[model samples]
Target: MKFNRSFAVLLVPLCLAFGLFALAQDSDDRARPAIMGSTIFDWTLLPVKVSEKGESRRVLRAPTATLDELECHVTTLNPGQEAHPPHQHPDEELIIVKEGTVESLVNGELKIVGPGSVIFQAANQMHSIRNAGDTPATYHVIKWNSPGMLSLKKAAKKMQK
Candidate 1:
């Protein structure tokens, strides 16, 4: 094959640019933890373990490179079962009901909600959720820490102790 010097010069820069682009993409993926990246979790495939008050499955928990923390899980409570006594924390939490009903007590206000309902509990406000149906109640709980809030992993570990 006959080669041209000008063509070779152009090819060199193209190859270098491609190499640098690929390296940048790989570094971007590595900079963020896998759990902190976008993920799709199938709740049916995850094993359910008994929580302090009911059955639950941890969906995800990871610290992001941006100094934020996320913790999520799905919990199932039997009829009349309470996940925990009324408590308050500094992390904001969101609960999405997937099945049955839940009686939520947020900062002394009570409300009964059903499937597909979303509940937002603000930071440091007393809250509790219990099954308010005849069957088991299932819901997804997603909690995250604000810039000035306490670390979610540390708080969970401390509660376990």
Candidate 2:
């Protein structure tokens, strides 16, 4: 095939622009939700990970089809152990008791709740959960926000600095 040198010169920049555009689109897609349909997550199958506070079986920690900061995990706090001191975050959260009892402190008020109980903590509200029973207390922590919580974390870090 016969090629024109001038045409090739113009095509090079066009191809580079197209590649850059595609890369930007890909980056945007990553920020958006990746799941599209109903999904079932089994807690028993998820691997357990230990944090400074306690042990957790993280179910999902990614953006969902409808939420930007959808996170769900099963946490077990040993008797006499609390999940860190009372703290607050910008993301709203719910703790659903599954096994044993828990002492839930919200905004300095303490309440003991048992299995099948749900404790709702609004955004930026101080709250903490501790095992009230003699055995380990297990609960599911589910949280979500309109936008991701990274901005809140970054802002908090800046304030500390």
TM-score of each: 0.68, 0.74
Among all windows of ten consecutive residues in candidate 1, which has the lowest summed lDDT? 145-154
Tally clashes: model 1: 0
lDDT, model 2: 0.85
Candidate models: Cα lDDT each: 0.86, 0.85
User: Which clashing pairs does model 1 show?
Assistant: none
Q: Write the per-residue lDDT of candidate 2 for residues 34-135, one digit (tens) a residue.
A: 753567897668999886556889888776566666788899988888987899878888999999899998777999999999999998888998998898
Give per-residue CA lDDT, model 1, range 1-161, as digits (tens): 79999999999999999999999999976875654666788868888898656799998887655536789999999899999899988788999999999999976888999999999999879999999999899999999865545446577779999
> Any residue pairs clashing in model 2, and if so which?
none
